[model samples]
Target: MDCRRLGEAGPVVSRVAFGNSLTAGNQLADDSAVACVRAALEAGITTFDTADVYSDGRAEEVLGAALSTVPRDRVVICTKVGRGAGGGAGGLAPERIRSCLDASLKRLGTDYLDLYQAHLYDDATPLEETMRGFAEAVAAGKVRAVGVSEWAADELAEGARLAREMGVPLVSNQPQYNMLWRVIEREVIPACEPLGIGQVVWSPLAGGVLSGKYRPGAALPEGSRAVAAKGGDNSLRRWKFLQDDTLERVQRLRPLAAEAGLTLPQLALAWTLHHPTVTSAVIGASSPAQIAGNLKALDVALEPDLLVAVDEVLADSVVRDPDLTLSRMLRRPRQA
Candidate 1:
């Protein structure tokens, strides 16, 4: 696997990060999750990303166990805090940051995290306090670098400023980036490029919608993210790609994938990594084969003409409004 630096100052990590957000709950069994992590390690993906709120910390335990046998220095472990489960308290309050960091370290069975991120921008807490909390973690050797998730361009810039003042490197920003979700392109990319903060993107396949398995008019596949969202009010809004119009556009990309000699999912991943600002694309898998298949995306080269064609094909379905990032962040309550 090819490696890339998180930013001008952060640690170098694999281009593809193995995401463990789905390790627990009904998504994946403990043993299966361990096997998938092993598969990723064997395939040369050295970066593993998890969060404290995922499955209420069970995901971190599973990931820590999976990497226990591997040498500590051989892999980069990344995780996040600030978000709470079950609508409980959640924010980047200093005390919460410290407490969550300690909890994550215990759960991961590690002394320090390579990258520790605020799961979201906390409107409730002062950014300076959050930066100080992260700086304290760095000073005490509990975290290597700090980052944020789903932060708007302005929020990120201010955090970067505060992080610099605290002498802590704000190295990464985790966001949802994919063929259908291009919200980051208009502003986030431009803002982070100058700050030396790299993007670690999630949902590169748009929650599996870009995998070409969800046909325009066919029944949703069992266990798919789409299927799981069947009755939620946010299902349609969250998964606009499930609509026939969008799925038809997605289907049109199959020929493009074939031209590149790649699977649809592989094509989707390659598209995200094509951008210069992207440091890594976090991929989650329920099986070993899924891990292996996604790793192949690194080998596929997207031509300029092919990319242009892709934009033309999905132009109507793509979400480009930059405000969506901030609006989504605002929708979540801030506490803790």
Candidate 2:
């Protein structure tokens, strides 16, 4: 796999990061999850991204155990804070930031994180407070670099300003971007590129809609994410990409993928990475074979004409509203 600098100041990481939410959570069996992580390592994916809120911290536990066999320095471990873990207060409060980083480190079996990100923009806390907390983490040697996820352009600008003043490198942003999801392109990319903040995009496949497994008129395929959602796995339903129109548009891209000698999923991933500001596209796999297939995207580059054809096929269906960048604060009863 090809490697790239995570941002202006972060470590060099695999262009395709192995996301742990799917396999490490309850969605997959424990052995399968561990195997999938090993499979990613075998495929040369050196970057792993996870969040503390995922499966109420089980995701990080699984990832930690999976990485025990590999030397820590060989991989970049990127985890997130700011979403409440195990019933604690949520948000980017200074105390919460420091406490969360400590907990994440213990769960990940590491002394320090390559990158620790704010899972979402915490509007309730002062941006200065959050940046200061991150700076403190860096000072304490608990976190190497800092980043954020799903932050608006204005919020990012403010955070970047604070990080600069604190002498901390606000290196990366984790946003949802894919062939069908272009919301980040409307403003976030513009704001981030100038600040030297690279994007490590999530949902690069639109939650498997771009994989061509879900057809426009066909029934939900057995064992697919849509099926999982129907069985009450609501996480995969966030994208809303399985709609008839979107599926039809995705189906039309088959020929484009064929022309490029790639699968539809690879085409989508390659397109996301084609942008100059995207440092990595996070891919979650339920099995080792999936990782092998996704790794192929590192070699598939979409020509200019193919990129235009993608836009033409997805015309009017692409999600580009800048306002979608704001994440809603979720309130849940504290865990026992």
Q: What is the C-alpha lDDT of each candidate?
A: 0.85, 0.85
Q: How close is candidate 1 to the true structure, as a TM-score?
A: 0.93
On the 0 to 100 scale, the lDDT of residue 74 in model 1 is 91
234-273 per-residue lDDT for model 1 (tens digits): 4334647688989899999999999899989999999999
Best-matching candidate per lDDT: 1
Query: What local lDDT does model 2 show for residue 328?
Result: 32
The RMSD of every model to the true structure, in order and in angstroms, is 3.0, 3.5
RMSD of 2: 3.5
